[model samples]
Target: MFLPTTIEEVKKLGWKELDVILVTGDAYVDHPSFGVALIGHYLVSKGFKVGIIAQPDWKSEKDITRLGRPKLFFGISAGNVDSMVSNYTASMKKRKIDEYSSGGIAGKRPDRAVIVYSNLVRRFFPDVPIVIGGLESSLRRFVHYDWWSDRIRKSILVDAKADLLVYGMGEKTVLEIAQILSRTRDIEKCKTIRGVVWWSSKKPIDCHELPSFDEICLDKTKYAESTRLQTILTDPFKNIVLCQRQDSRYIIQNPPQLPLEQEEIDNLYLLPFERKTHPFYEKIGYVPALDMIQFSITCVRGCFGSCSFCALTQHQTTHVVSRSVDSILEEVRILTKHPDFHGIITDVGGPTANMYGSSCFVRETKGQCEKFCLHPKSCVNAKTNHERYLELLDKVRTINGIKHVFVSSGIRHDLVLNDPHGDLFIKKLIDFTPGQLKLAPEHSHPKVLALMRKPSVELFLEFKEKFEKYAKNSGKQRYVVGYFIVAHPGEGKRENEHLRKFIEEKLNYHPQQIQIFTPSPGTVSTAMYYSEIDPFTKEKVFVERSLKLRNAAKANLMSLNSAR
Candidate 1:
């Protein structure tokens, strides 16, 4: 059942007032892939009346006040993707299509949707506690660089004027907040919850202090230092509390929420999700994002790859968590029963598909390792086994009504190459994948690859050769699609030319998946983009800051096939 979006629907449920209302920047889809729905359903399961207002018209009070405000708090999210990224392109051009919106139309959500939505709610309710979360809020919880404005902005908690901010996967954090507000009705008592950030007049004792907003604004070096500190302290095992001054007030961030246990994550995915767009969007048109993921299943959570440009490490963290095989198979059975079921499961993995059931024994016992598990070199303590994931795939293919099961999520080739059972896993993956097996090599130049924290191009070449041989042996015409990024930190005209030559000679194909890098908030790449200094190495790096040059590099790569 869909959560009530209007007062009439709320009254039909015999509820006088809802305990929580979630506002999102995307159209309402009651699917687990949608953040607002997953959170709303979880809150409902905890015996609280929950409602949602999606993509509310920010200019007026109509949609914001339709549900009449909640008793506990208002939850705000900028949808699955950050709002600014959703609204604009890497070149700062306005985007024409929003997959999360009705009919793939753009302009439904404002630029900074989190801040806009929170302000709208405050204008109407005036007294309701506001809690902001999701990808946009999570990455912006600290004073970080904003590519759109090309300046350092204070923590989102300050700009949004929100009462509290929840970071990371927020299921447990939000639940705790709801329960506390229900019993005590005091927002002050919810400050110490893990995975939450709140503002205080004075800094808390024993907390790690980051550079003040003013200092970072004036000194780019200080900004880079702050990014370095935040990255190391991200380990939940460290239990580090971070504080930064934002003008007169201080923003205190508690330690991240610990990774969910196996049983906990297992039950979270099994929550009652209709897995379809709400009837409210029927007249508007189909939501493009829902169509892409309705039949797909998320078999894992979190990633350990820690790519410099990727935000998974900041939001999902480096802890790798996978759902039980039984839970995944059960969900597949349920998907087969859906009215839209077509015997095909589009995807069955998380941030990195092959990392499912993989873990680091050293970190599991001691804590986060000083080095990344898969970068530079595979750590000795890291477990690179793919046997359990292979077993799960074999069992899934035998289920009735399941015609095809594909791993559409990003696959870390380096991890597969290091795994003992990589050969068997690759053979099985090739069979499950449809026409193309997608992999992100990012770039070909060693210097650029190093800055991006991706493995060398040699690893990709090794994997591609094996993939082609296996596909030929199996009589399938499968292809390996390589994804690359242009104009990342340390990439110049020389680096771009190197990438073009490698694609033409080594890859031997026209690249279809190429992107101009966008310096989003709370990433090492973004810190480098803003400061022109590597946060880890503390050395100066070349940055392509011209928008025209960034676009030209992508155009040059895309035009390679025609030129050939």
Candidate 2:
């Protein structure tokens, strides 16, 4: 059932007051992929009365105060993606539309919606506890670089004046916070909750103190140093409480909560979701983002690739957690029974499709900060196997009333290359791909790939050869689509030219769409974009600063010979 969004809906629930009110930038989508809906659904399952205020009008207190007051706290999320990144393009120009909004319209939510909503709630209900989560808060939990302003900004917790900032996959942490606050009705006492960052003037004895916000702002290198420290402390097993002084008070981030186990993840996914936008938006229009994933299933929660430009490393963490096959099949049965079932399953993957059931043997013991599992080289301990995933796909294919089970989510080609049984996996993948199999090779130039922490281009070439050989043998007319990013840090005229040449000469394909590197908050690439120095090596790196140059590089890549 959908959560109450209006006073009338709340009255239908026969509740005069709600335990929690979730405010999000995106229109309310009750799919597991949507953060606001997932959190709201989970809270309801735990017996808390929840209401949603999605895309509330930030211009006035009317929309913010429409839900009345919550008994516990106000949960604010900037939807699935960061609001600034959502509202603007990589070049910092305002975007024309938001895919998450109804009818695919723009300006539904304000820029920096988390801070905006939190401030709005604080204004109307001065003493109510405000808790912020989702990508905006998680990635901005530390003092980090801001691409829009081209400078360092304080943690979102400090800017929003939120009572608590839940970072990482926050299901466990949020539930604990809610339970504690439900009894105490105090926000300050809710500190020290795992996976949450709260403001505290008193420094704990064992906490790791990051550079002061002022120091990082004055010195770019200090900012880099703080980021390096922050990355190392992402492990849930051995992480220390991290404290960074924003102004007078310090932002104290507790140790991350361990990712949910297989059973827990299965239970979470099994929760009943309306799996569509709320009916209130019927007059407004349909959400394009919801349409894409409405028939899709998310089989995993986190990414292990840890790409330099991606924020998954911070928000979803480096740990790989997956659901049970039985649970996945159960969800598939539910999907098959859906009224809109079209005899096809859109996707059955997560951050990376092939990373399901893949993990390091010592993940619980040592932690994930040693080095990347895929980049440089696949770690010896990294279980790079596709048998389980292939098995899951095969089982789903034979289910009654399912015609085709395509993997829309992009799988890592490197992991596929590492798999000893990769040949069979590729053949099965070709049979399932709707048209073109998507691969994110990110860049073709070696120097650029190194900066992005992506695998070498040779791997991509080898994978392409294998995919073609398998596709030809299977007699299936399938294409291997590649995604590349231009103007990333360390990509200059020479690097861009090299990449373009390689795609034309070796790959023999022209990309229909190109992406300019967007340096969102709390990413290693964003830090490099701001500091002009690699965080790990502290060595100077080249950065393409001109928007014209970035756009020119993108145009050059796409203008390559179309059907070579």
Candidate 3:
């Protein structure tokens, strides 16, 4: 059943008032892939009356006040993707289509939707506690870089005037906040919860203090230092509290919530998701995002790959978690029985496909390592075996109504090279891929790859040879599609030319997956872009600030000869 969006629906459920109301920037789709839906369902399972108001008209009080006000709090999310990224392109151009909106229409959600929605709620309710979360709030919980305004902005919690901010995958943190508010109606009690950030007039004690907002704004070196500290201290087991002063108040961030265990994640996915777009959007048109994943299954959550440009490190954390094989197979059977079900499964993986059951024993016993697991070299403590994933795939293929099960998510090629049974895994993966496999090598030059924290291109070449050999033995016409980034930090004209020549001579095909580097908030790459200095090494780096040069580099790579 869909969550009540109007007062009539609430009355039909025999509820006088809801305990929580969720406001999102995207059209409501009651699917697990949608963050607001997943969170709403989880909250409902905990015996709380929950309602949702999606993409409310920010200019007025009509949609925002339709459900009245909740008893506990108003949960604000910017939807599946960050609002700014959803509304604009890498070139800072206004986007014309929003896949998450009704009929793929744009302009439904305002830029900085979280801040706008929070302000809208406050204008009406005036007294209700507002808690902000999701990708946009999660990454902006600190004073970080903003590419759109081309300046540093305060932590979004302060700008939104929210009572509290929940970061990371917020299932655990948000529940705690809701319970505390229900019991005492005191926002102060939620300050110590893991994965939460709140403002305080007094400075916190025994916490790692980052550079003040004024200091970071004045000194680029301090900004780089703050970014480095936040990146390395994300381990929940370490119990690290972060504090940064923004004016008279201090924003106190508690340690991240512990990564969910296998059983916990399985139960969360097994919630009674309707797996359909809400009837409210019927007249508006079909949502494009739902169509892509209606038949897909999310078999995993969280990623361990700590790429510099990727926000998964901040939003999902570096802890890899997977659902049980039984749980996944059960979901697959359910998908087969859906009204829109066909024989084909579009995808069955998470952030990285092949890292389904991967883990690090040392980190489990100790804490996060200073070095990344698969960056410069694979860590000795890391387990790179793919046996469990291969077993799951083999079992899934035997289901009664299943025809084709595809692994559509991008796989970390470095992990595949390190796995003992990688060759067999590659042979199996070919049967599922729809003619093209997605691989992100990022760049061909070593200096550029180092700045991006990706593995060397030599590893990519080695994996390409093995993939071709396997495809030939299976007698299938398959190809390896590469994703690259142009105009990233440390990429000068010489580096760009080197990558272009390598793409022409080595891959010998026109690349369609190239993107210009976008300096989003809370990423090491963005720190380098703003500071023009590498955070880890403290060395000066070259940054292309001109919009024309960045576009020219991408065009140069795209116009390569397809001599395959």
Candidate 4:
């Protein structure tokens, strides 16, 4: 509850002058925040005058008047709305989980339960229109099994139970809602807008489909071996299928993917972003003095790299489209001119750095490649032109006062090693520059890597060896860093032992740079974790977060690399 300075002061501020108020259910993630701010900023941009109530605990009505109770419309999120399964559970799918948990941060009021927050708001602001969106609610738009809680849960619809649910991208929908409400359209009139999920009498209705999109029907007969810009842009799956409804309901079924338009590409670069600096900076109390920043430009929209243990293909689909070098240069110039410009660029790359303005087949396809080459061991376009990326790097390096631009973005090494100029391209980096090249080998054992559908351990080793010899030859000493996951559903202590031995026998993995595996949402690994199958070995396995074992395992990678 937000306390007004005093009852007299609160009363003096004149409690009821505003037309509408917006409430959100997130405790700011401090800096380098996520999409929550995007909606808020957009609302502000439209001139609706909004107020933010940071992480209000749902149990109390005492704090509802913190802003003096003007007619309000609330926005809520399920706190990054992720689905997590316990590493220890019976049948993995036998858990029923809902409610926000404050992410276990103290002083962080338990605003973890979005349902509770909305219900409380109803009790206090009964006539208020509460709209819910964000990952949790969006993903939970329909009934589905809550693996953590093990039961069929209703759409986040009946639960946090707001007036309406805004699923999918909130940009256009939110914009329309703002316009209507700002012009004094009845709250009921909002039901007319497309893209909004609303409650009519009792059932949920996904109103209209303004712009339809095509879905890449995964079934081979329906799906092409390769996807293209127009095919995806005109996707037919405008409705998003809520949890487990028989037919596609609530979901856009088929909504448009961002098309590869020159202007849209340029627009993406203009959006605001904050760096995701490490947490330890705060622990050491050095946040204020730190100058690190994270810069990102989307290289492409979809990924067709179907590692059965993956979801990029399912969620984002696979179509490669990119921004022009000229557009990218403009953004870089903007960053460099910022008042805090420090000649050092800590990170510059995309979803995969080696894949800029590239498709599986180039010359033959006229750059309009349909499939990122589903054929062989190499990327869709390995033998084609590699000059574009090299040129991009050179242009970036020449930026006014840049000291050293680091490619912290992970690189798809398979693409790097196969490109005609692959080895030489990297050679140029060693010949002139600073930074580590990120390779996500994921796992080492051939069986395990095969399970991951990622490059083989042998492939990674070959790449590393070349990188090492290149470094030695050029007299450059920065290292080739690798990121691997452990305790996966298929990775038993024995399999993990193989990983340990492989690291020792091969490219020494390092501790400082290793990422402990956490089954993040929307990844295929999560399915395996949910099913309790290692997939490759088909053996029952546990996705363990062995802190002590992980520490030791990471030390093995670091010490071995240091010695070499």
* Most lDDT-accurate candidate: 1
Tens-digit lDDT track of model 4 for 1-564: 121222453455454344334444434322222345455545544545444455565557655556554444666655443423222123233233222222333333342245766787778877777777665565454433354453334556667767666655565566667677667745677765655555433223533322111222222111121121122232223323211222333332223223346565455445544332223223423222123334434444444455544434433344455667887778788768656567766555555666666655342233323333331265545443456877777787798977766665566777777776788876765633454666778887765665566777777788888887889886778567667766555666677778777766665544455544545333445445544553333555455545466556555555665676
Score every model by TM-score. 0.99, 0.98, 0.98, 0.67
Model 2 Cα RMSD, Å? 1.3
The alpha-carbon deviation from the true structure for residue 542 of candidate 2, after best TM-score superposition, in angstroms, is: 0.4
**Global CA lDDT computed for model 2:** 0.87
Residue 348 lDDT (model 4)? 52
Model 3 spans > 4 angstroms off = 561-564
Clashing pairs in 3: none
- lDDT comparison, 1 vs 2, better candidate: 1
Off by over 4 Å in 2: 561-564
Query: Model 1 over residues 1-564: C-alpha lDDT tens digits?
Result: 889999999999999999999999999999999999999998998899999999999999989999996999999999999999999999999999999999999999999999999999999999999999999999999999999998889999999999999999999999999999999989999998999999999989889999999999889999999988888887788889999998998999999988899998888888889998889899999999887689888988988888899998888778888899999999999888989899998998888877788777766656577677777977777676588887888788789999988888998888888877788878888878888998999999999998899999999999989988899999999889899999999999999999999999898788889999999999999999999999988989999999999999999999997887
Badly placed stretches (over 4 Å) of model 1 are: none
lDDT, residue 348, candidate 3: 87
Query: TM-score: which candidate is best?
Result: 1
Taking the tens digit of each residue's C-alpha lDDT, what string does model 3 give over 404-516? 98888889988888877788888888888888887999999999999899999989988887887788888998888799999999998999999988888888468899999
- Cα error, residue 125 of model 2, in Å, equals 0.7
User: lDDT of candidate 1?
Assistant: 0.91
Q: Give the TM-score (vs. native) of candidate 4.
A: 0.67
Lowest-lDDT window of 10 residues in candidate 1? 361-370
In terms of TM-score, which candidate is stronger, 3 or 4?
Answer: 3
